[model samples]
Target chain A: MQHLLATHPRRRLFQLSPPATKPSREGVFFLPSIRIGLAVLALGGLGAGSLALAQEPPAPSPERSRELIRMVRQDCGSCHGLTLRGGLGSPLLPETLRDKPPDGLKHTILLGRPGTAMPPWKTFLNEAEADWIVAQLLRGFPEESK
Target chain B: MRKALRAWCWAILAFLPLLAWSAEPTLRGTGDLGVIIERSAGRVLIVSTSSNSIISKVEGLGDLSHASVVFSRDARYAYVFGRDGGLSKVDILRGTLEKRIVQGGNSIGGAISQNGRLVAVANYEPGGLKVFTADTLEPVADIPAAYGDNKLSKVVGIADLPGDRFIYSLFDADQIWIADLRDPKAPKVEKFSNIGKAPYDGLVTPDSRHYMAGLFGEDGIALLDTWQPEQGVKRILANYGRGEEKLPVYKMPHLRGWAVAGHQVYLPAIGRHEVLVADTIHWKETARIAVRGQPVFVVARPDGRQVWVNFAFPDNGFVQVIDTLSGKIVQTLEPGKAVLHLEFTPRGETVWASARDDHKVLIYDTASFAKLAELPADSPSGIFFTSRAHRIGF
Candidate 1:
């Protein structure tokens, strides 16, 4: 699991902060690492921070990629709508997901949104595979056959 | 005499064509017709239960990802609810699409009123319920599930009740609303906000006396007795897991597929690979039967003699059949890859299951546990039979 997390470029973003020493009245903990990371990036004057953070992961082989694409179109499509138009889950079309950062989408795919029907695919997919899916979704999703 | 015989032969030949026409089967009289949803291909295969053959395949309906169907009272027409919010009325006897309408941006499923006059859909996009005339599919009422400063909540588990009313669970708001469509133009809404947290899905019992909603944010289920609505909702099986960590829920358990056998109800334990048996009289967990994987649909046979269950992804290929009397898994069958849904024949003598990965629908004999036949499908999911016309919620 650790190895899989390392392959994700945005892993550091989630791991930036350490666990809170105490919980608040509402039982929610605030992460200070995110503020520190933002300060560091601002001081470095890196306007292309998002692009730098989205470092491409190791690509899957062509055959393996095709299999992953089919899984997304059929299995993932079960809830996301076969056409990616949205059903129980939100739409996955490029237009609907255009504003979402690629790295964020990758993180979501790896560690599903808690309290929702989305289940983390880290058990079934590697970080690299999830990155591939995010990239495909940003563009147009592939057809099931060709 | 020869000339007279020739004339008679010609007359008999002319009558032969009329005889063949009369011998053709009538659409309305044909019993046990069902529909198999081809999810990816946007088509539905109309199958005859008695012959176990494909009657016809209706096409052009769009985005059947989470498609569901409800039958008309006469069992002649099937109203298919597509994921793209396309409501289509299909004539089972004619094996053709009668009427189609795009009601919403995205819909999960729908229910037909007890009187068979209205069809209501639960939508997620705009977050509301839409009711339409059962015959013409005309818009009757639009009830936006608004709560707390005009915020909309996605509707789930909408089922028709006895009094021309529809009950649905709100996934986002964590409430249940009963919409009385006594007058198709205006519906009286009764909101039960204190039901529980994140009521994912719900279903009305076969007798239509109780409505139960499964909670996602908490353990246990919320129960409402329609006969005694003023008493409010009762929580049942509150500590099902007993503080133990639950297995990660791959997919939300669907209460619509829960089964009732005799005086007991069989339900899929959320996030767990077990089927929980609850007594209808006491509304308490009686027994938990371990199964192969996370149970998706724990459907009871028509006779309520046995219950069939299918699992979630990775373990989706296997199906387990349990004997209701003994509360034990009697047999296990592999119906191929990505087995999504199951439906039983009118008499519950046979079961039909769809394998999405294999692109085939398998039918098995319930009593003998034998493979009966297989029909080729395209990424099939839900198998709905016309017999649903007789049930409370389909």
Candidate 2:
């Protein structure tokens, strides 16, 4: 680990959602943002410094209901339109996850799926927050939640 | 009613990552690779495939029904390439699907260049390779393949090596293709003659010096020198079937999925339930050890000590485990029903698998080699989990 760190190149690109909206990448395969660091490291096989680029939560209150809607909006909207309608990601606007209980919903949110595009987020969210969002999703998200 | 339920499920899971990941903890690579694991009594499947050592999950993403997945070049971005060509690219760092690009036609396999310049999608039905600009998400070029040439050819897989080029395997056509995307605007397509009757799958060594081609119709692998692609070191049979009589015209005996790690090449053969080995240095046939049945896909560990194999269709659901050193089947994991794909984390700690009909992504302990847990995926195929998860949608 230290070997890679000492040799690691500093990737200037930042996160996957780099400042540039077009999001050019290192190649057709690498996500643009992270590759900046990797490519610099991969340069001459010098493989160096490791870095993780995201914010973790204990999200401040907008209430659990509000956060859930935000989560839904972020997750569903990221690919499907933020409207939660449907795009590459299937539609989620209150119809899909409505039937599953808050518990089951939390499971889906924290544990990213294996075969599908959906990844687990237990590391990204606390159980309580995941549940909170599911509950609010089961019911409704007030405009204030947004 | 079911439609509505399904819709809500998608909505809720989709949104949680947005809220959660936007608020995830900062994680840096500690020189350790991320892997897939199950938590909370196996209900949650966490994939630490992002640059950040965190996971982004979606509810019902691993429902055990059936699911498909695809990953960008570095595994930072993953797309659930689903039925009807549905694609959802995820943010591994955030553990969310941020973009979904619904392709008009059916795509089977895709490859991303090291520079993030191109994403070549191997499409079925339409029978051609569709090239897209990874950065702009625009159609760069669509190379029409000879799929229905007397129905003799069907493009199966596409691979993007270190440089700005790619190699594709044609199903029935005793041929392979190398497309040069030097200009991005004008791609120079070149056909590399096949050494066997049917070249199913192949892999490019990390150095991009040689391409190990697998012949499903023939009884072994064809070792092609990428430098002189038009020519070859000729065919290096993995020694499948009795003696070297070559396969009958109608038979598909080889059945290998080719994959490379660092320097070594792994060839998974169905006939022997063994993984054929080759020294990537010399590109010579090394050894072959038997594993479980019908091993289709082969994935090598980061250090190249082991190669994980996934079996499809028959053989009743098993992941034939191969030991690289001995070139033998170490164990067979029974995941059950139409297992399509297999991959390990960067650190080679966990193994993630997806079953086509089961609609589930099964998690296994790489160290313990146990059936740990499962996640729900929606008609997923060609699964991949990057250490860095970008938000993907579609």
Candidate 3:
């Protein structure tokens, strides 16, 4: 199963290609089943990558994740605006980030953008943690608890 | 014998009120007061400069990320500019918020007119500046920062001049505009374009004669003579960082933090771990003192004998004191984590520093370099003293 997941050329092509277009008329009948299969394949690919990236970033605990969220809202928010709308730094809203890839955003968080006010957070956050932050930012940041 | 004792007791009781009156503590005047910004909590802690103690806490300010405060002429009121564009008029004496207005979407800071009647805010969003009445904060004049082809530019480094005028640098357009507020309703603007690239922040000289803007895109400062507006702009220290490898700047060095002591002005060397000492008269770099980190605020004491400097992240915990005469790091002290700002008392007897991560404001004796006192704060950053009221563009 692992080998099949790793060597699947069609799945690799789907992952590398731009977002897929509408299915052809001949493939329309099997579209629903194909979609389900693709979803499973994508999940498998994520798992494979998780195992391959040198050392996987531990899934942040609930409390740790909450702290990270607050840090982004307050600390990063210093330059990025409290609402993350935009200030001295550019906006970080989901819409503004639709074109930005998740990996690229994560790299920016870890290494920081040179010649700008964005400082590298590698000392404070791990690669996986940065990935988590990018994911949350893309899906709309969480609000602090009252 | 009983009658005599009773008379004695009555006499002592009569003098008690007089003694009590003599021992009563005198009220602190507004001039002896100062404010410390609590960054995360959206609050300002009013403190007594004499005793170095927190007097009161004014709360409910919006976003204090890059917050700054300027005092009214009487020093009774404080105008706080928040990053979220909230302009709050805090009465320092009454320990209350008099008025607050959301002037724009984002703002770096603001300046009060020399006469203390008009307040001008430098805005990032919607890209313009808005002047308001100092007393009521009522909108007076709206100046859209449009450059070429109706392009709006974010305003930075808005400072007040001696002649009821305000000067500001356009961040995106690379221009400087001096607004004459002799008539608050209608300001006559004198624009100087193509001054420099990316004038991030600026400050007016203590004499209010020279207006210098720090350029981020280049390794120099743009200077304009307020006295000679027709001379256009001059670039100073153009090659200060030439042949040196530039470091990543995690934070922008504030030109307001540059200090003039004696014949020299101390400026934070951009993208370098040093403070450049430049001659005010010659406008040339004389020497540079290596520091622990990228210099943030290089402020001189009121007496002009010593200058204290803070650093950017990773080395923000340390502060170095430079003796102006020696042009060297005389002393280095670690106040605490993230020492964001430093402010001197009216007489320069004491300096107040805020350590944001440690949640404390440390007071140090200027002469002895000893810790005088520490006040607990919530992520404290900027320490502003009422003595700023006397300065033209504080």
**TM-score for each predicted model, relative to the true structure:** 0.85, 0.55, 0.84
Interface RMSD values, listed in order for every candidate: 7.9, 18.7, 10.0
Per residue, candidate 3 scores C-alpha lDDT tens digits across B1-394 of 9999999999999999988988876455898898889877889999998777999999998878779999999999999998877999999988998899988877879999988899999988768889999999999999999988988898998889977899999988989999999998878999999998889889988888999998887788899988999999999989788878787676678888439888888888888998888899989999989989998888988879999999887688999999998887889999998888899888899899998878899999989999999999988988898989888779
Question: For all the predictions, what are the DockQ values?
Answer: 0.25, 0.01, 0.21
Docking class of 3: incorrect
Cα lDDT tens digits, model 1, B248-276, are 67666788754888999988888788888
Higher-ranked by DockQ: 1 or 2: 1
lDDT of 2 by residue, B1-394 (tens): 9999999999999999788877867665422333232211112233443332325454322211112343454555544443233344555555554665655334435666656667667654345677776654577887777744345244654566545787777765667778888777888887766467656556656555666667765576766677876575367754566574321111122222235654567776634555666666666767666655545667776567777776533453677766766666677777866565676665667777766446677777776787677776532334444532221110
Segments of candidate 2 deviating more than 4 angstroms: A1-146, B1-46, B49-76, B79-83, B86-88, B92-104, B146-153, B243-264, B281-284, B335-338, B355-360, B370-382, B387-394
Clashing pairs in 3: none
**What ranges in model 1 sit over 4 Å off?**
A1-59, B1-30
What ranking of all candidate models by TM-score puts the best one first?
A: 1, 3, 2
lDDT of 2 by residue, A1-146 (tens): 21121122122112112222122332322334433433453332222221221221233353444444544553343333333333333444333444445567678778754434355667547887776555334322222220
Q: What is the lDDT of residue B215 in candidate 2?
A: 72
lDDT of 1 at B62: 81
Off by over 4 Å in 3: A1-75, A111-126, A142-146, B1-28
lDDT of 3 by residue, A34-132 (tens): 334433543443332212221223447667776787678766776686667667777776445647767788888988887665767888888878987
